[model samples]
Target: MPDGDVNAHRRIPRPAWDVINQLALRRCTDETHSVRFRRGSEITRWTLAELDQRAVNLARRLHATGVRVADRVGVLSTNRIEWVLLDLAVLKLGGVTVAVEPGRFEPERVIEKYGLRRLFAEGETSRDAVQDIDSVLSLTEPPGTDVPELPAFPGYDEADICQIKQTSGSTGTPRGIETTAVSVNSSISEVQELFRHGDGDNILVLLPLWFLQQRWWFYSALVFGHDVALSGYEDAVEMAQAVSPTVVMGVPRLYDDLRARIRASGAPVDLPERRETIQALLGGRIRYLWTGSAPATRATLEFFNDAEVPLYEGYGLNETCIVAKNHPGAFRLGSVGQVLPNKTIRFDRDGVLVIASHHPVNTRYTWCNPGDNQKVWLPTGEIKTYDLGHVDDDGFLWIHGRVDDVISPSAGPNVLLPPIETLLRGLPGVHECAVYGRAVRFLTAIVSPNPDLDPAVLSDRIVALNETLRPEQRVHAVIVAAEQFSVRNGLLNTQFKLKRRQIEERFARELELVYDKHNGDAAPPVPPVLVFG
Candidate 1:
């Protein structure tokens, strides 16, 4: 589709490579001393020209190692200047960059599945893993290795595939999603329109760069000639105070942590002066705050809304590259926003959300198998999003949960798990809760109590929490497990999201006993020998 017709449901225009090139050229000539970081006793500044040169050098070095166009080069490192440089370098070489989120996956698992040939590490610890790579490039000069230093290289066309980011794989195995320079440019345009970003705007990037959404914020700011402030390994609160960014992007957990910190500091929650301080600190110059990667809780939304900061919650997957997003002007508290101009959305007979957009939906770097690909239909040549949601009366889109996760029993209507889980997590003393309907009559819960408080206190808290829940939505009883749900235990995927199927299967026997007892079909067997911390 031509760029102009992207919204008209036509083919997306050819990729635009000049966007980054122009930024580099202008940075070389004009802005020589833009401050990138500002913390007490630690300040860093870089000119566009310097960044361009470094990116070119990194690209040249990568190509010298026999990397070619469309090759999947994995980068496993923390957020830093090198991470950005490697991304730009990959774009310059027309290679696909697969960024691994920190602390999410085992090194061996990442290598085995992704077939990573080359890797860039931030330190020795990261470099020690992944033995299959032909070469290891250290951004921080880890000791005792023959890895080459980054070099300068030339640029490539904007139409080239720049990055191949893996899906969060919160529910299943991770799949690489190919994003072309053209699609990225389209994404930038979409964000610019959605957020109304313009020149002189400062976008604070608090989330990790490996997250595809954060990449959108970075590109959008750069394409619009807005200043980009990056926080490296700093706490979210400290970053906010130091950067004083006009725009901030975060997940629900990040916002919740910030709110908790603010409240714990004895700051008056309802004071007008404190509210103004927060607005200026986080949104003063900021026009909007964006949250996603998971659904935002009502409490998080209310906290920000009461502070007068517009929280634009969006919805997308790696496969589609942000098909839907809420705009500041068209904000809705519980909705993920309307479909993007270039996309079409509708519900399947089962209430699964589907999307159709102009960009090519699949690429060689990441191939959705026949089974999975079949779920994303091109009935009218539009890619169907497999999520479950509905367009409300006001034309806003509200996502309930995944279609596959809707639990229906012979006794009643299907129960959506996400909303219920969100409500449960919001209750006092509840750390994390996973809801799954087992057998026919019972909804079971596997809960983790907050370690900071006593178990006796948590039990009382859960009782109070139950009062706020609908009877059917409430868990019959809670199991205070010693271990937290995590990817390492196969209970969660790398994105820190619950893997319901895995959790259920792992504890199937215990759940069966619970179900049989509750239904009065049989006497309850002895409780499983589960340990509690």
Candidate 2:
């Protein structure tokens, strides 16, 4: 992806932070109510003035510790108001911040590779992960730390790398994506304008602060003088009753779980009244719902649509920023909405989606695996998104599949994963599964059945589930995996996500026999090297 010509993207720009910083100051002095953090039975809030003063105190502490401009820092913690304040404090000092996903983050590797000036984690995090660096400190001070007076933060500019997003790689480790201050500010502005976000909106925060989908909303709330309601991962329907948020956003899993829970209750999922009941469970004031990170389940989407819930889908990566999104008056299911305003999209000769925008985007990578750089940012200021997709005649983008996810064989239709994997996950006896159809005779899958069920019985259940599929979509054979993909097994990313390519490699030999049996002239013997029941 090359910048080609930036004519379509050029806009008169100012740093988004400085402008929003001023807004925070104004709101604080006006005593405007700003944030609400939820605990078991308590909803604590802070006025802009109180929030500003606390942030200033934290900034002074950071400065006291010799934090300075242009230094890279790492944050490994969960979502909280303090996370945003620390992030803003970093930006104020012209330092760069990196998010380390706590569940799967390798703290020591990040500290060495990024040469972090400091690392911040929740006090509750394992001491082993925090290590013994003087730079490793709790995100906030305990009862005994002293604070001295300090001057106001001078703030940063386009040249300063304000944040680094660690992209999980196929190999299980992650590479850092550097985002400049200008890029972040412009993204905040664009998202605010696109969503028509204003000061009056009460946003319900669901995703963790480390994720771009959630992190940007925190920035938006600060910029627009809105309120944020932090909810934990639980029954969102129950959580909504506590917060009464006007908008809710999360990954596809959050909604999928809600749909499953509703169906289990024997409630109707298709009728208009049922949709309203689902919405009511979420505090009854949701203007629209939004999901990203992965494709939404068709069942979840259809369920919400019948309930008249507007669920928008978006597509982007850390390197490319927000590429395209579905929104009001312009949305299509199975499509990732329209190309966002001011962004230009085109497909390469290889059918890979390429995005170009003039807003000061990320320029380079830090600690990327070999050959991964080709898929990140290029010299042309364009992002080479390896995701394969094309723009429709109506200007919407539909993802075809990843360049590496294809399972093309000698004489059958190719199989694309996720769609296959997600379907398998819905079957009763199936606990976990993955599909591989590349260069084989037909589609085959590796499965981990529920632990409580008999192995042969579960395999038979999968065979029955396969009959519900079309010829190309059907799984002709199933390999029973010895265990579920997990962090301990080195198959799941730190975020507990499947590193599909890695999983395939780990089971390469086992799959060869599975595919051979499905397409072989003779009934193939069960894999001897594996624990196939």
lDDT of 1 by residue, 1-533 (tens): 11122245355544333454443333343352232654346756666545555566666666666776667677777666666767766666656778877665666666666766666654434343343221333421233234354334354455566666766343455556666665666666677666666666677776677876676655554455566777742455566666667777776666665565565566665757656766755645656677887788888787777777777788876666677778766877888887776566666566666665565434333544545544454535445555677788877888877766677743556677888788767755555667767446646666655545355655565566556766555555455556766556777554446777777777677666666566563422122212242
Clashing residue pairs found in predicted model 2: 3-380, 28-48, 28-49, 104-494, 275-307, 407-437, 407-438, 408-439
Displacement of residue 241 (Cα, Å) in model 2 is 3.2
Q: What is candidate 2's lDDT per residue for 467-505, written digit by digit as tens?
A: 776656666667677776665687654334566777778
Provide the global lDDT of candidate 2 against the true structure.
0.66
For model 2, what is the error of residue 22's alpha carbon versus the real structure, in angstroms, after optimal superposition? 3.9
Question: What does the lDDT read for residue 99 in candidate 1?
Answer: 83
lDDT for each candidate structure: 0.61, 0.66
Best by lDDT: 2
Off by over 4 Å in 1: 1-43, 63-72, 101-117, 122-159, 168-171, 198-200, 232-234, 265-274, 277-286, 361-365, 368-370, 377-381, 451-471, 483-495, 502-513, 516-533
What's the TM for model 1?
Answer: 0.79
